[model samples]
Structure formats: structure tokens, C-alpha cells
Target: MEFHHLGVATADASGLAALFAELFDAPVAHEEEFDGMTVLFLELEPGYFELLEPHEGGAISRYLENHGPGIHHVALQTDDIEGALETARGAGVELIDDEPRPGAWGHEVAFLHPKSTGGVLVEFVSH
Candidate 1:
């Protein structure tokens, strides 16, 4: 597996994007909406940075409120998403999705609950 991206939950997407752009010289590569989340992709050296803002009342928004804005999840690039999910399950990790689904950047991904990952949400995405 390889490092894919870091997901940051923010209440203000444009503002955060601007901050990152100015601070790190990152540029917005793309933007999309998926699974009730508004996402913006910012290009970086190693991989990408993703800013996720809830489009409606949901878990991401709740996370923002309770956690107070920071790294929400870490994404790993995988050759097989199903295999990764199975591995996580065998290791007793709780999965947020029962099956791999469409994700940002034209990949299929699944999420493992933070409770299973030392309080860090982990996402596995098919490369």
C-alpha cells in the first residue's frame, strides 16, 4: 500500500483551500460531490490533499463539531479494495461501508471506523 491522501474536515471549504494554497503553494486540482460530502482535491508533492465538507447534516459535520477541525482520515492506495476490506475485517476492524463504492479521483474505496484504528479513520482506495 502507498500513501494516497489526507482528508481534512472543515466547515469552510473555500477558506481552507485558500489557506492551503497560500501556505503550501498547493493548487486545487478538482472538486466533486460524493456520498453527501463536498470534496476538493489539492495537489501536493507526495500525493494529494482532500478537504471534505458536509453538504448536509452528516457524520463529517458531526466530526467537525466534536473534533474541532483537523485530519479526519488517512487514505491508502490499494491494488484491491475488496481484499483490503477483508483484511481489515479479519483484523477486527469495523467497516463503515459493507462494500467498496465510488470515491473521489475515480477510485473505489471503503472506510474503516476510527474505533478500529487507534482513533483514526482509515480509508482504503483501489489504485
Candidate 2:
């Protein structure tokens, strides 16, 4: 697995995207609306910063309500998502999504429960 992207939950993706573009020289690589949120991927050196802004009352909205705007999850790239999920399961990690689902950038994604991942949400993404 390799570092893929850092997911950030915010109420203002455009604002943060501008700030990050100037601060980190990370221009927007992709932008789309997916799963009730505006998803923007800012290109970094080797990875991306995925900014998520919810347009409806869903997980991201709930996250903002409870935790405010901040880092949401860390994604790791994998060639075999099923194998990675199996590894996580074998390690006793709780799975939030037992099966991989469609995610931003049209990748397959599954998340491990934060409670089982040292309180930090971890995502496995296959592009």
C-alpha cells in the first residue's frame, strides 16, 4: 500500500482549495460531485488532498457538525482491495464498508472503522 490522499471535511471546499493551491502549490487535479458532496482532489507531490464539502445532510455533514472542519481520513492505494480488506479483517480491524464501493475519482474504496484504527479513519482505495 502507498499513500494516496488525505481527506478533509469542510464547509467551504473552494475556499480551502484556493488556500491550499497558494500554500502548497497544489492545483486542482479533479473536481466532481459525488455522494452528496463536492469532491476536489488537489495535486501534491506524490499524492493529493481530497477536499469534501457536503451539500446535504449526510456523513460529511455529520462529521462537520460533530468534529468541525478538519482531516477526515487517510487513504492508501492498493492494487488488490479485496486482499487488503482481508488483511485488515485478519488483523481484527472493524470494517465500515465490508465491500468496496464506488468512490471519488471513480475508484473502488472501503473504509476501516476509526475505532479500530487508533481513532483515525483509514481508507483503502484502488484506482
Candidate 3:
């Protein structure tokens, strides 16, 4: 697996994207409205920064309520998502997603529970 992107929960994705563009020389690579949120992927050298702005009450909204705007999860790109999930399961990592599901950017994604992943949410994505 390789680093894919860092998911950030924000109330203003456009504002943050603009700021990151100027500060980090990152450009918006992709943008989409998915799962009730505005998702923007900013291009960086190695990977990307995925900005998530919730449109209504949902996981991101609830997350922002609990823990202001900040890093949410880290994603890793894999060739085989199912294999990765099985590896995680074999290691006893609790799965937040027992199976892959549709994610932003038309990728198959699954999440591992943060509690079992050193308190950091980890996502496995297959393009």
C-alpha cells in the first residue's frame, strides 16, 4: 500500500483549498459532492489532501461538532482492497467497514476502526 491522501474535516473546503494553494502550491485536482458533502482533492507532490465539507447533519458534521476542523483519516492506496481488509481482519483490527463501499473519486474504500488503529482512522482505497 502507498499513501493516498489525508482526509481533513472542514467547514469551508473552498477557503481551505485556496489557502493551501497559496501556501503549499497545491492545486485542486478533483472536486465532487458525495455522500452529502463537498469533497475536494488537492494535489500535492506525493499524494493529495482531501477536504471534506459537510452539507448537512452526518458523520463529518458530527465530527466537526465534536472535534473542530482537523485531520480526520489517513488513506492508503492498495491494488486489492479485499485482500487488505482480510489482512486487517487477520491482525484483529476492528473494521468500521466490514466490506468495501463506494467512496469519493469513484474508488472502492473501507475504513478500519480508529480504536484499533492507534486512535487514528485508517482507510484503504482501491482505484
Query: Which stretches of model 2 miss by more than 4 angstroms?
Result: none
- lDDT string, candidate 3, 1-109, tens digits: 7999999999999999999999999999999999999999999898999999999999899999999999999999998999999999999999999999999999999
Q: lDDT tens digits, residues 39-115, model 1?
A: 99888987788999887878888988898888988999988888888888899999998799988768888999988
Clash pairs, candidate 2, are none
Higher-TM-score candidate among 1 and 2? 2
lDDT, candidate 1, equals: 0.88
Model 3 C-alpha RMSD vs. true structure (Å) is 0.6
Task: Find the 10 residues in a row with the least total lDDT in model 3.
Answer: 118-127
* Shift of residue 37 alpha carbon in model 2, Å: 0.7
The per-residue C-alpha lDDT of model 2 at residue 11 equals: 96
Per-residue lDDT of model 2, residues 1-127, tens digit only: 7999999999999999999999999999999999999999999989999999999999989999999999999999999989999999999999999989999889999999999989999999997
Question: Residue 58: error of model 1 in Å?
Answer: 1.1
The parts of candidate 3 lying over 4 Å away from their true place are none
Please report how far candidate 1 places residue 33 from its true position, in Å: 2.9
Q: Is candidate 1 or candidate 2 better by lDDT?
A: 2
